[model samples]
Structure formats: structure tokens, C-alpha cells
Target: MSLFPEDIASAARAIIADYAGKAWMIATAESCTGGLIAGALTDVPGSSAVVDRGFVTYTNEAKMDLIGVQPEVLAQYGAVSRQTALQMAAGALRRSRAHVSVAVTGIAGPGGGSDEKPVGLVHLAARCRDGRLLHREMRYGDLGRDGIRLATVKTALEMLAELG
Candidate 1:
């Protein structure tokens, strides 16, 4: 069986096939889902033709440094906000050779949740080189850490496919 769930694997396969047909490459910027989105994409054979790289920016500093997320954006909106997700997607596309990019940031945990920003609240964004952008806010309740991360991965993959 594939290491990724069937939905994720199938989504990854579709992305590879579609992007490869168009000679497009994909990049991922991940936080709460870690590199799982990229891992799922790369799991498909011949993904190298469509996937350029993935950045696991689990920290604010990493997000700023690796993907050029503005320090001001992180400070004003925190790492898990839509502003940050958009910047992450744009930055990934700017830094990589990829023609499309997806970004995710969120709190996935049994702890670290506040009334305003609860656990399982995720922000995802996708950008295409032609300036197409998409964003989604997912409130998955308290699905624990693993569940939240997996859900984020699934959503991120779908965003990539949508952008592709």
C-alpha cells in the first residue's frame, strides 16, 4: 500500500500527470502539515518533472528566510493566518523554479489553541505563475495532531491540483 492515504496518493498522481503534460513544476511551503504535502507529491513516480522543491517552514524565521515571507506579515497576522499563507505561496513561487506553488500554515495540536485561533484551524493558499491565487480556511475542529496534519495535506494537494 502507499504510505499516503489513497486520496492523497491519487491527488498527487493527478497533479503529476496534469502538470507534466503542461510542463509545469510545483513547489510547496508547509508548516503545520510539515513536508507531508511535498512528500505526497514526490511519492508519485516521475514527480521530479513536475515538483521542484518543498520548504518546511515550521518557524517564523524559517518562513521569512526560506520563502521570503515578510517579517511584518508574520508579526501582524501570526504564522497561521491567511496573510501569511498567501505570502508563503507567493514566496515559494518566487524562490523556486516551479510554475505553481501551495502553502499551508496552522496549529495542529491537542494544545496551543486559543479562543480566537483554535487548534485545527488551518490556512492554505495556492499561486500560479500567471498570478492566479486561491485560499481556504479550514476549521477541522479538534482532530488531534495527526488528523489535522493529514487533513491539511489533503487540502493542500487539492489546492495544487486546482492551481495546476
Candidate 2:
């Protein structure tokens, strides 16, 4: 059995199939979801042709070092903000050979909730080398860590498909 939910697995398969048809490759930059977004895509057979690389930037330093997320942006808007997500997507595209990229940054928590940025809040961004970009802010409200991360993965995959 697949580790991901059926819906997620199905979406991943569709993304790989569609992108592969166009001879396009994909890259992922993840934070709160860890590498689940990449994991989902790589789970599908033949994904080797479609997936280029994945960056699990769980820390501020990793974001900057691995994907080139600017330190100023992270300081100004924090890691989970739209700015960071956008930079991450752009950075993934710049850093990889992939034709498209998706990025996710968020607070998936049981204890990290604050009045302003609560648990289950996620920001996602996707970019295409053709100059297309997309962003989504999801407020999944306290669905617990695993739930929030999985939800982010699903949405990230959807964004990638949209870009493709």
C-alpha cells in the first residue's frame, strides 16, 4: 500500500505523467512539510524522469544555503510567509535543472500556534521557467502536524500540476 492517501498518490501520478509527456522536470523546496511533497512525487513509478531534485529546508540556514532564499526576506517576513515561499519557488527553479518548481513553508504544529500565525497555516508557491507563478495561502486550522503537512503536500502537487 502507498504511504500517501489515495488522493495524494493519484495527484502525484497525474503530475508525473503529464509533465513527462511535455518532457518537463520538477523540483521541490519544502519546510514544514519536510520532503513530503517530493516524497509524494517520487513515490510514483517513472518519476525519475520528471523529478529533478528536492530540497528539505527545515531551517533558515538551509533555506538560504541550499535554495538561495535570501536572508533578508526570511528576517523580514519569516520563513512561513508568502515572501519566503515565493523566493523558495524561484530559488528552486534557479538552482535546479527542472523546468518547474514548487515551494511550501508553514507552521504545522500542536504547540507553535500564535494569535497571528497559528497552527495549520501554510503558504505555497509554484513557478514555471516560462515566467508563470502561483501562490496559495491555506488555513487548515489545527489539524495536527501530520494532517497539515499532508494537506500542504496535496496543495503543492496541485500547484505544480497547474504550472505544468
Candidate 3:
């Protein structure tokens, strides 16, 4: 089924409501999951009060241009590494008026499998209100592009809850 993870939708609603009550805005910089995290948040009726915007930076150049990710970071660690994820999140928080931001980048594919960075290699990071950043990496196995993205979105939602 090409559908969203239901657990994510439930958690996202709580996160949205929490941030809305705090009057804090959030943003997303997405790659492997496109804008699914944003979509999940927007699924909640009052999400507009907490979500400011989302940036789907699916390419390295887009990540650099839209989120201010330094070229040096990409050159040193590539786009799917923790360093890049941190840069992406920080850049999103810096550029957007949102109080916080999350970033995701990875090779979510059935063809991009490799020993180092396999098909389900996802890296996630978040920049919180106090200017702190948290990052996590996961290999969701070869669940194909959609599956990997869905799993990533679910994990991202958990991270969002922690951020909330």
C-alpha cells in the first residue's frame, strides 16, 4: 500500500498541537521523504499555527542553495551523512522564520544499494529552539523507495515529538 504510516499521523497531530499551543513554528528540509513529514503535520486541522513551511531539497545543489548547507560539508561527508544532516537542519532553522526545523536526506531506492550507504540509508537531524541540534541515522533495509521514505517519516515524527 502506497500510504502513510498511521502511527506517524497520530504522533504528528500531538506534536502539532503541542507546538501550536506554544506558538512555535516548525519547518522541514526534506529529501528522501520528499515533504511527507510536512504533509503529516498539515494533516492535523490546526497545523497552520505551528508549521511555517517546508523545503524539499532533493539534490545536493538544492540543499546548498535553499538551506545554506556549506559546500565543504558536502564535499567532506556527502549529503547522507550526519554532518550534512546537521547542516541541513541548522540551515533550515536559520533561513526560515520557524522556531525549529528538521532535515532528512538519504538514498531511498531499490537501485542505489551499496555496502556503505545502502538503499535505505537515512540521516535525520533537527535544530531546536535553543539552537541545539540532534541527529540520527538508520538503515531501514531494502524496503524500496516508498517503504524507506515511509519509515523515515515515522522516525522523523518521533524526533519531532521529542523536539516538541
Candidate 4:
């Protein structure tokens, strides 16, 4: 009955349950997928206990202003790189009270492909208050914009569960 895919739904539920059980809160730093990852987490019935905040940094300025991503970093690595993803995750934790956070930056597009950074190239980073960071880079091929974004959400949720 849910519009979200089964993997996403289950992962969201698991993240909420696990984090809430541990009395831990989560934050999100999102791009490409907009706030879809945060939306998935909030879809759970009692997500409020675990979800502290979500940053929809769709633009470079937002990423810098809201989450403290450095201008030099974006200028050097661009938004969709592992460096930016790590910085975004670290920034989310620094800017919020969450015990853990996940950051996603990607090119979910039908037109943004290039020889190097093609469409569906997503970089995900999860950071814990304990200072542990995990990163995943995925090449989802040309699955179209919606497909790539949804896939990123699913992957981000799974990473949240793992971090939880």
C-alpha cells in the first residue's frame, strides 16, 4: 500500500526502531534526492524520537550555509564527490544534536552525464558521534532521474540502519 519500495520502507522502519531504542537521534544532509531520504525516515510512525533534523542542501550555497560545507571543498571536488559527502555528514552532526547523520550527494539525471561523473553517480556518507565515518559510492547506471533518486533514498536508509 505504500508508494515507497519494500527495501526503503523496511529500512526506514528498522532505522527508526533501532535508533529510538538506543535513544539516539539522526540527521540528514541531502542533495540530488532533495529531502527524499529524510522523507522516508519521517514516514515511519514514531520517527520523531530518532530524527533530529534534515538538511535539503540542493544548492552549493545551501550546503555551505546550512551544513557548513566549505566553499573550497565544493569548488575543488564538486558536490557529488566523496570529499563533499564526508564533509556534509560531518557538518550535519556538527550543526545538529543528532548522534548519527547521513549525507548524500549525487547526479540523478537524464542529462548530467559526463565521461567521468556520469548520471546516477551517488556518494553517500554516514557519520557517528563517536567519530566513525562510512562512505559508499554507487554507479546506478542510467536509471533516469526518479529511479536514481529513489535508489539513493533506499541506499541512504540502509546506511542509516547500519549506523543506527
Candidate 5:
């Protein structure tokens, strides 16, 4: 019995398998989900052909320093904002030699709920081919810390699949 959702993992495996023949590379800038997306991708055999790197920028400082999330953006929109997500993806794309990049930042928490940003609020961004960035936001609605992170990872993998 695996701890992760079997079907999502299977789908991720399929996605990577489909892209394995081509010279595709994936880079991840993660926050709420840590490195779960990268874990799922690397689970597949020979994922080195596709997974180039993963950036686990779990803190505001890390998001800024590692993935180039600017201080102004962090101050203006906060660390978990969409603007930060986009910057994180762009930074990952810039830092790594990968063809595609995905960034996730969020408050996957048991208690970090406010009127504007709630516990399950997540922001995701992807940059594909020449630094074009796309964003997604989801309020996962109090699914606990681990649950929200897992959900974010699942969605990130699916978004990566869409890149194919």
C-alpha cells in the first residue's frame, strides 16, 4: 500500500513515459508542496531524460533568493501570491537549462487562514518554451497541511502533462 494516490502517480508515469522519447526537461519551483511534484516525476524510471531540476523554495527568503522572487513582489503581493509564483517559475527556467518549469507557492496549513489568504490557498505557475508563464490559483478549503500539499503536487503534475 503506497502512501500516495495510486491513480495520480500512474497518470504521472504515463505522462513522463509519453515525453521520454523527446529531449524534454522539467524544473520545479516548489513551496507548499515542497518537492512532491519532483518526487512523483522521479518515481518513473529513466526520468533523468525529463526531470532536469527541482527548486524547493519553502520560505519567503528562499523564494526570493533561489528563484528570484523579488522583494517588491513579495512585499506587494506576499510570498504566496500569483505574481510570486510566476517569478518563481521564470527564475527556475532561467536558472536551470530545462525546457519547462513549474512553480508552486501557498499556505498549506492547519491555521494560516485569513480573510484574503486561507489555509488551503495555493498559487501555481508554469513557464514553457522561452519563458512564457501561466498561473493557476486554488483554494483547497482546509484539507490540512499535508493534504493540500499533495493536491498541489497532483495538479502540478497534470499541468506538466498538459505541456506535452
Candidate 6:
């Protein structure tokens, strides 16, 4: 199952309430969760005041083109690595008018497991306008695609809240 809209919106509401008229805007760069992180935030009423834009950079090329993720980073650390996550967050902030940015890159699967990077491994990064950056690495251990994605959305939103 996907994320419940109400649950997602509830979290989003806190962010909306906090940032509205505070001159804060948010942006998202998503990978394994697609655009779900942005979707959840948009579900809340009055989110327009806080949400700037979202980039669904599902492919390495898209990450590089849409958000300015360095191709060398993708080649060296892979898309799901911490370096890429940091770059994604920075890229989102650079490419948008948002004051804070959150980025999600992960492998949520039953097929993408490996000795190094297993399934359900996610790297999340949040960057604030003041240059504070936060990174969290989650290993949900085969929570299935939807479960992992939903958790990612929740965590990404929470990070945005922290940044705000």
C-alpha cells in the first residue's frame, strides 16, 4: 500500500503552518520514492506558501540534468550513495528558490540487493539555507517497495520540518 494521504498531510500541515509567512520555501529531489515526497507535502492545504518545486530525478541522467548532480559523483559513489544524496539536496537548493531542500535516494526493492548496498537501503539529505546539512541512512530491510517508499516520504518530510 502507498502512504495514506491524511497521515502524510498531517505531517505536511505542521510544515505549512511553520513556514507560511515565514518566507520559507521547500523543495524535494526524489529517486526511489519517485515524487511521493513532494506529493505528500502538496496534499496539505496552504502548502503553496512553503513548497517551491520538486524534482523526480529517478534516473542518473535526470539527477544530473534537472538538479545539477555531478556525473562524476554518480560514477564514483553511485546514485544511492551519501555523496549523491548531498549533491541532490544542494542541487535542489541551487536550482530552486526554496530556502531548504530535501533529497531522497535509495534502493527499495526485492531485486536490487547486493553485498554492499542491499534492498531497502536509503540515503536522505536535508540542506538549509544557512549551510546546515543533515544526512540519514536507513536500512529498512526488505519492507517491500511501498513500505520503504512510504517510510522515505515520512522521513523526508520530517527532515524538511527540521530544516524549517
Give TM per candidate.
0.98, 0.98, 0.94, 0.97, 0.94, 0.95
lDDT scores in order = 0.93, 0.93, 0.88, 0.92, 0.86, 0.90
Cα RMSD for candidate 5? 1.5
lDDT of each residue in 134-158, candidate 6, tens digit only = 9999998898999899989888888
**In candidate 4, what residue range of length 10 has the lowest lDDT sum?**
1-10
3 against 5, candidate with superior lDDT: 3
- Once fitted onto the true fold, the runs of candidate 1 whose alpha carbons sit more than 4 angstroms away are none
Put down candidate 5 lDDT per residue, 1-164, tens digits, no spaces: 33468966786687688767667788999988889888888888788888999999988999878878899999999988989999999999989988889899899888777989989999998889764567899988998888898889888877787776
Candidate 6 — which residues are off by over 4 angstroms? Answer: 1-6
Which pairs clash in model 3?
none
**What lDDT would candidate 1 get against the real structure?**
0.93
Query: Poorest 10 consecutive residues of model 1 by lDDT?
Result: 155-164
What is the lDDT, from 0 to 100, of the residue 60 in candidate 2?
97
| Superposition error at 148 for model 5 (Å) | 0.6
Clash list (residue pairs), candidate 1:
none
Write model 3 residue lDDT over 1-164, tens digit each, in one string. 22446687788878988998899999999998889999988888889898999999999899999999899999998899999899889888888889889899999887866788988999999889796677899988888888898899888888877877
Candidate that beats the other on TM-score, 4 or 6, i.e. the better one? 4
lDDT of 1 at 34: 84
The pairs that clash in candidate 5 are none
lDDT of 4 by residue, 1-164 (tens): 45688888888888899999999999999999899988888889999998999999999999999999999999999988999999999999999999999999999988877879999899999999997778999999999899999999988887877776
The residue-level lDDT of candidate 3 at 75 comes to 95
**Reference-based lDDT, residue 136, model 5:** 92
